[model samples]
Target: MAAQGQAAAGSASESGGSPAASAAAAAAAAFPATSLYVGDLHESVQDAQLFDVFSQVGGVVSVRVCRDINSRKSLGYAYVNYNNTSDAARALELLNFTPINGKPIRIMYSNRDPSSRKSGAGNIFIKNLDKSIDNKALYDTFCAFGNILSCKIATDPSGESRGYGFVQFEMDESAQSAIDKLNGMLINDKKVYVGPFVRKQDRENVSNNIKFSNVYVKNLSDTVTDDELKEMFGKYGTITSAVVMRDSDGNSRCFGFVNFENADAAAQAVQELNGKIFNDKELYVGRAQKKSEREMELKEKFEKNIQEVAEKFQNTNLYLKNLDDNIDDEKLREIFAEYGNITSCKVMRDSYGVSRGSGFVSFKSAEDANRALTEMNGKMVGSKPLYVALAQRKDDRKAKLQVNIFLHGSWIYTTCAFMLFHNSECLVFACMVGEKSGEFY
Candidate 1:
């Protein structure tokens, strides 16, 4: 798929087309393919199992079941490639939602380019869905409007519907028709809300403009009373109610809430009073939010901070595996000290204080780490070759592994499967040797 896009772009550039035209050609080429993404497979499903099912429709080129790099567990999805597009289409029509290992699989044309999907051209969001509406029922309901690229009922971990879902058609007209005809219509005795799907960031931006009549205030002086608070904020707005929060003994808790008669007045009070010194303390004032909203905002802020920290240390830390047993913190540092100044180095140990054969090294700069990684990776250290790479946070590493497994599907599946088989054989051989040497006895 990627090769086709690259070839299309290359031909367009060779023909003296504008850069925009070249990019357009590349994107156009990416969509026409004979590969299909099969999702929601049972964990036990493998490439051979998928090939058996898909090959019934046509000549199968390749099948791959993506798995986690570390756990070697199925990711509940697979990719099947056919020799021709017609057979692929036939498979999609006939085998979609077919039960495999007692679980129904969803099939769709594999789209490598994300721009078309992210454009939200033909997507609609439906809410207030009946609990019993599953993926198949949703698909059957909307398929009449037009060719649906994808339809799903948002489900919780236990597989119960979450009262909402998304349906994406191949044409915007179909999505509009569904929204017009079905918005506020009764489905399963529930009034459903159908509307054009808005991305989360866009939704958040829209919510930020909503007006509020209640304002939150903090950093109050201990002696401040409700009457004092009302008097201070009454200059900007008509105070409907004001209270300084207190403990059971009636001692001020250093925070309070003020309600204005109108949203405009509340907004003006917040704008003027925020960051203003009152009772010798700076006050923080803003539109009051529910607990969930405050939590969501805090979570987003925390994630942003984490991303900034990750970016600040990118490529400056290295993870090392297969370390020699003799390698301690000082020894590890000495090994990479020639490349750069070491910030920290540690060989991981178990509770028994034995080296776990892995460690980490952090350099003062990314350049030094890169130099050490390039020179030391796979180099023989003791009895085994070292495995070295840039250290990644747990979540980042998992995401990268998933992307690698998806993008390099077939090759990763084959290589990892073979490695697993080879390791099993080596373990058996070691057991045999140990038995003969009476080591087990």
Candidate 2:
């Protein structure tokens, strides 16, 4: 029922049930439908200006531009009330998207109950407006395109222009026409941006929030300029903007971002230029990632690599300690090969190139490794008892250094500390006498 254009006003009494539906809906509304939402208002617009503009189509009972309580500055939008619903609807059609004081204004039926409102479904968002443009000027510019329901420019608490605003059109065709004709048109020497309006939450979830067609490129030449970057990527399609990151001194950071007017152009640039050698370095071109997302990706990659390495050596590697310094890789393999075929063996060495009295041995299967561990653990070697266990990664070995042994049913307690050596092979046990026993490691 709200989706009406200039024709909708006179045709409200069409034979279909639309008129009845609209009447019934309006009657059920908490507030009278004789109120209109007027947005894209310039910060300088006063209640008098709103009344003057809206009274052209109807007898305006009141006009109010919302303002901050403390600062008393215009909030960039206002509401207009008329004694009759027909007058309100007429005002919405004639004044919407029309320029007032060189700025385009938006008009729509006011629905104070946000839950019942369609939000920005029939609205258009415009940005990059000139600060000096006023509501009247904006309204005059776009009034010809459609029956605008409301127009407004956002403002800061202090009433300064936020350089953006919204316009609500009654009909989808009118809104689309405005978008097609006025998007990218220069206003006050600044190129304006125009698009369909959406809620802030919806805007955030969109994949191309930054731009519909954008690409991130890095490893660029230090000598590259914004113009150069744009020119380079412009081959695929019309370029909108290209910026090379720079330092305060104006030196290029060798990275840049490029935005095209078409998504296919951006995809083509990513495909053709990624890993392409430029300025003696391979370019890293792809979709841009926010700082937080990039950090998370790196962390996940590191963890995945660690897990892969851990799985690669699972069950096949055995840790051996208490070996004599004379043990070489060949002799170590020879001894472990008794149970099954030994794939590899190596005794860790010190700076002097001598064995550190420990080594790791890999068997063909987990069964052979387990058999060797079971049979050789705590068994006598040449001069000392050997300790055999599953070979652990560096992090795992450090974790096992702190062990807590339970001594149940024992009244006496001793503080035992096991000192681990640099190679993680030697363990020296020391104890201090204590009088009472509790849970201790």
What's the lDDT for residue 310 in model 1?
Answer: 39
By summed lDDT, the worst window of 10 consecutive residues in model 2 runs over: 432-441
Instruction: Tell me model 2's lDDT, rounded to 2 decimals.
Output: 0.68
lDDT values, one for every candidate = 0.71, 0.68
TM-score of each: 0.52, 0.34
In candidate 2, what are the lDDT values of residues 209-316, reduced to their tens digit? 344376888788898889988988899999889999887899987788898889888888888988999778788888765544444444444445443443454666
Tens-digit per-residue lDDT, 111-204, candidate 1: 7779878888899999998888877767656655655667788874334577999988777887897777678777777788989999887888
Query: Number of clashes in every candidate structure?
Result: 0, 40
Error of 2 at 359 (Å): 7.7
Candidate 2: stretches off by over 4 Å:
1-212, 275-282, 319-335, 341-367, 374-388, 393-441
Best by lDDT: 1
